[model samples]
Target: MTQELKVINFMGIRKYTSGFSIILTILAVASIVFQGFKLGLDFTGGTQLEVQFDRPADLAKIREVLEEKQLHSPVAVTFGSDADVMIRTQDQMSIKGREYIAAEIARLGNGASLQDVIRPTREQEGFVDVLVINNLTPDQVAQSGLFDTTRFGKTIVATKDNTTQIAIEKGLDLVYSQHLLKELEVATGASIKLRSSDSVGPQIGDELRDSGGLGMLCAFALVFLYVAVQFQWKFSVGALVGLIHVTIVTLACFTFFQWDFDLNVLAAIIALIGYSINDTIVIFDRIRENFRKLRAVDPIEIVNISMTQTLGRSIMTHVTVFLVMAVLYVFGGELLAGFSKAMMIGVVFGCYSSIYIAANATVAMGISKEDLMPRPKDETEGGADLTP
Candidate 1:
């Protein structure tokens, strides 16, 4: 004989779970208030250099060299492999020198050219002109002071239809990759190559940080309106409370671990809001349905029944999302680490809030069968009096 499935009484322990949720929310808020996030280059404005070496790089030596050069608090970390390293510096002081070094190494290799080693800057289109100077001596390339700033800042003229027009003036700080190379004999020594470089100015970084905050605020407002329209104001309040709980706890994870708060992490938090709201809506819908069907049942029993009915679906949904996030966290590397980690934490709390926070808050706010059902029309006044 098959054994019958038991109905779990989730609301039976609402007193305990609700108290636990309140304490957790307090701790999460306290953690966020006390420990601020460690903002990354995407928010703080910095230079990122992707470099590759012939062999595994000595991270300590790289850090020492960068420190000696007075680069701003440079952080060197390995990327996809041990041979590939990514360095982040608070300022863009030594980028030109690093590019010059890579150009020299490329010229020394047989039949190698500047384009073979040095990658162009992302802002190449902004340059007024580009010219290749291939046959300079090694000594000339080594002297960084020899680069003429006037050439970079000069105005270029173009003629068409017998009329002259001025092209955009180039910035004095623009570094051309083609002009940075020279000719030399190949040597047997190991060398590091510059794979890529990216920089964000401080002004842009501040704007991005502000925009991220605004985006989150907008999300909360939109969610509140949607829930209020779709259900009762009580349901909307529950959903908003649940969303706030998920957001604070997710942010608390970042603050407690001192993880990098970048664009990806911000995106993850927004996504968590959507995911958490979706789960809460499912339970709320079930609760509304039960209110109409079980008119004689107590509100607390209806809530427990609704939660129990959706328990299987909730477990399956969150577990699937959790597994995917776990894979991303483990294999997506440092680039996706912050995003996936935030998602993993959010998934756990998202489930918890849907059950304890959203459902419990709805009950506490006095949801009942009458809220979901329509009132009967008056039958006594159905017809007008003929005497009138």
Candidate 2:
């Protein structure tokens, strides 16, 4: 004879767990209200420049250089590797100033081309912001006596039409490459390259912040509608409660830790809503099934039985997801740190909300067998009736 499977009394303990859930909800709300998120460059609006060097860069020296140039509040930090650095500044440099800086970097490297330094923005006429290449060796360029300095002006100017002509006359090559910044590292022994650059305006940042919030609201609204249509209103309400709980708690963690809230983090929050709703719907479906099958059992007992039946599945699913998120958090690097951190937090809270918040909410809203049963058709309604 097989031993009987024991039904865990999950609903029986709801009284205690519900209180804990309420306390957690309150604390999460308080944290979010009191301490706001640490917004990232995507939502704060600033200039970011990524550079790579052949060798590890001296962060302090880089910072000092920016300071000397009067860049306001310039921040330089190591990226994935010591040779890779990302710099953020409140001020955006002018095209002429950028070209001058490129020249300075080329001098530091030994020799570099204009194409190896500044990023070009092509206009209908030609490349508007052209970098002038000093073909002279570092030593010759350093002498500052070979040519008329006044003719070159402060920055190198070149149009698409004259670029090849200028290169031929100057005994230099006019070309373009994504890794022009890397050439700087080769020329002067400083071995630096410009990887990428981005600049965001303050107004654009504000718009992004507002749009992110609106996107989250839209996601929740859609979730509520989907669940309500697929299941009963009570089930939809329970799932919505669970989703809200998970979102609030996740955001609260961000606020409490003062983590950078960016577009990636926003994406993670939307994903959390989907994950939490899926888990809630699974449990809700099981409850509805048990309600119909266990005719003699009380509604509370049926709920407990349903939770017990699905507990193993829930555990396995959450554990698998947690492992993947853990790997991402540990190895995805600083660029993906915010996304992985938010995902990890969401996974944990999503599991908790599905079990405690969603299930308990259904009970509080007075879910019963009748809620899942089909309503009787009205006798007066016109329909084909067949007697077999």
Pick the TM-score winner.
2
Model 1: lowest-lDDT 10 consecutive positions: 179-188
lDDT of 2 by residue, 136-227 (tens): 44344446442223323233334443221121111111111222333334433686767787778879989998998998899888988887
Model 1 Cα shift for residue 195 (angstroms): 5.0
Task: Tell me the TM-score of each prediction against the true structure.
Answer: 0.69, 0.70
Off by over 4 Å in 1: 1-5, 51-86, 94-190, 375-388
- Model 1 TM-score relative to the real fold: 0.69
Quote the lDDT for 221 in model 1: 90
RMSD of 1: 10.4
Please provide, for model 1 over 324-363, each residue's C-alpha lDDT reduced to its tens digit, 9 standing for 90 to 100.
Answer: 9999999886668889999999999999999989988998
Please give the clash total of every predicted structure, in order. 0, 13
Q: Report lDDT (Cα) of residue 209, candidate 1.
A: 93
Q: C-alpha displacement of 281 in model 2, angstroms?
A: 0.8
